[model samples]
Target: MSDISDFLNHLPADRARTAFDLVHYMLGKALKSEDADEVLTEMAERIGRAGVPLDRATSIVPLLHAEAVASARFWERGSGARSYLFPYTPESGDGYAHSPAAVVHETGEWVRLWLPETPDDTYGIVPELKEAGYTDYLMAPVFMKSGMAGTFSFATRAPNGFSDEDLAFLRLVFPALAGAQDILATTRAMQEVMRMYVGAEPQRRILSGDVHRGEVMRIRSAILFADMRRFTELTVDMSAEEATQLLNAYYDCIVPPIEEAGGEVLKFIGDGILAIFRAEGAGNVACFKAIQAAQEGLDRVAHRNGSPSFDVGIALHLGEVAYGNVGSGLRLDYTVIGRDVNLAARVAGLCGTLGEPLLVSDTFRGRIADAGKKTSGGPVSVWSVGVHALKGLHTPLEVFAVAVP
Candidate 1:
């Protein structure tokens, strides 16, 4: 390989200047941790101002994610950059196969197609590019050190297409662009992995260097503990794969409602779940949201009553929770703990024993009444399900079951 200094010396004066400026720009953006969209948008402006006919620019990275196949950002001459996700689907694959990027990815080759001379059927996107007054289209492979590949494409409205100098300048700056993209994509993938394992706040905290063990925050929260009913009996005859699917279906009924109501699902303890809703706005909003989330979760379970059905007992309690990192040695776990969390779990146990779908602790019930004072729904209706002796606690606690609307 030739030295970069020697390579730059061989380029024309203008192209060399543009390439040098762009390398510096890319480095600055990468060091500052600017997102790909911002980098691409600014890159297009700089290249165009440098006498390159860059009307549109795009960066597409094919990453392995649970839901998405690729992440794309496109910037146009007069518009701000926008992002799109190509989901893992047959249609997404079919669309990619008809585009020039797929060819660049498969062949590890660059493509420079003059859109005005090319047939509309040449590439799936050619007709749209031509209609948008673009005459030049270029796609180049950006291979990462991880062996995964991405594509960067440029389009221009200039009738003569991109000049040799323009193409050379872009090619010279490609390494810098690819380096920045690799960093951005890797960071995004790490964040995605964290999101899959932890709630939003925990993910943020961990990413922000707050991962030391014993780092905990105590806050008042409405805790909800729930466990699937008859999970073992229900899946006893099923195969492991089938049972796992059933469990996922059961969790689906519970997790979304909790997340939708601004509650964080902290842990999935086998068939049991522990989540919390912190008090926000006018005090008892956390209790109200927790109650509403429980009801919604129960409603979703009821909706899935037939064939492969799931039933759960949800219990809500209110108190302080110590939330954060707890573990030993090099390994760690982020979770919420406190007597209140235990009380919530105990109340959840009562749901199965008392044959109730939703149960609220006495403290939680009072908060519901208080929340009702501020909400349009008023106090949630409930009835005492008798004072029951929980496993750990000495005094018998009064259990209350919520009313169906």
Candidate 2:
């Protein structure tokens, strides 16, 4: 570990005091839950305020994401920070290959350019800095303990550029800054992964310390259950890769429309999807949106079908459900559980038997009626499939088939 105290002892008294104060300020901001961009911007501003002669600074940190890498740039003009997300592809035309940050990253060493003295043919950002009236530019690599690397570049417009003392101070503090950034980046990556795997609302609950098994909340919502028709028959003869591709294609057709209609997809059970449209205020908007989503999903799948077609069955129900963590102490899943959820699944099973692509339970239809005609644009019509006994339930359940327009 790099000790700030040890480094401060070597500096002259006045310089050491100023450096210590600045380091403490930076460290305090970093440790107080401030984000990476905020910390970096504050560090640059503080350095300039302490007479370090910094006019511009930029930091490029690579991310574990599908698209862009994150970066922040600060200019002295407004002392404001601007962030950018550079895409990973179309690499040939971005001019990133000839940037000073690229050189520092490739060589794992610092690159310094004195604008007036640097050769014109230098393969980096030197020419651009010279034109921008910057007298000097320096780029340093920040190599983390995990082998990930980032770049930090500093530029100055001062007549004499950075003094030796200023450069030395920056070199001493770089490690601490990089360490703070790594922590922030790792936290962000974990949150992103959680959001990707579980839905956003569940991830938020888990992060907020709702991890104990049986920690749950009862909430009214419209539950949606959907599954591919004849999935086993569809994939029995195909290779694993081809089967996987078909499943993805099917999801591509169905998932987005549900999300667009304000539903949270809970999980995928084999070829089936479980999602919920949450109730808002005192209305049955959740039920209405669930019905709309089911219709849109079926339409999308029908539109995507060609010679080798895929079909799906979906069902919706509205009632109270237990939403939270469940399972053994060693492992837990953030999901919903209740009779309503079970009822939704059972109703979905009737879709195939009734020869209907979409089905809605009596409970859901009742809620829509209770919300009044204005909420649902008047009474909606459905084909009543009289009370039928479902597996595990002794009482016969009334179900209705949705007539898609």
Q: Name the candidate that leads on TM-score.
A: 1
Q: Give model 1's clash tally.
A: 0
On a 0 to 100 scale, what is the lDDT of residue 160 in model 2? 92
Best by lDDT: 1
The segments of candidate 2 whose C-alpha lies over 4 angstroms from its true place after superposition are 1-18, 33-37, 66-76, 87-108, 113-135, 144-148, 158-160, 280-283, 305-308, 324-329, 370-372, 375-379
Error of 1 at 53 (Å): 0.4
Model 2 TM-score, all chains together: 0.82
Q: lDDT per residue, candidate 1, 91-154, as tens digits?
A: 7788888989889988988998987679999888988988899988999888877677788999
Would you list the C-alpha lDDT of every candidate in the order shown?
0.84, 0.77
Model 1 residue 208 lDDT score: 87
**Residue-pair clash count for candidate 2:** 0
Candidate 1 stretches greater than 4 Å from native: 1-11, 30-36, 63-65, 90-92, 116-122, 280-283
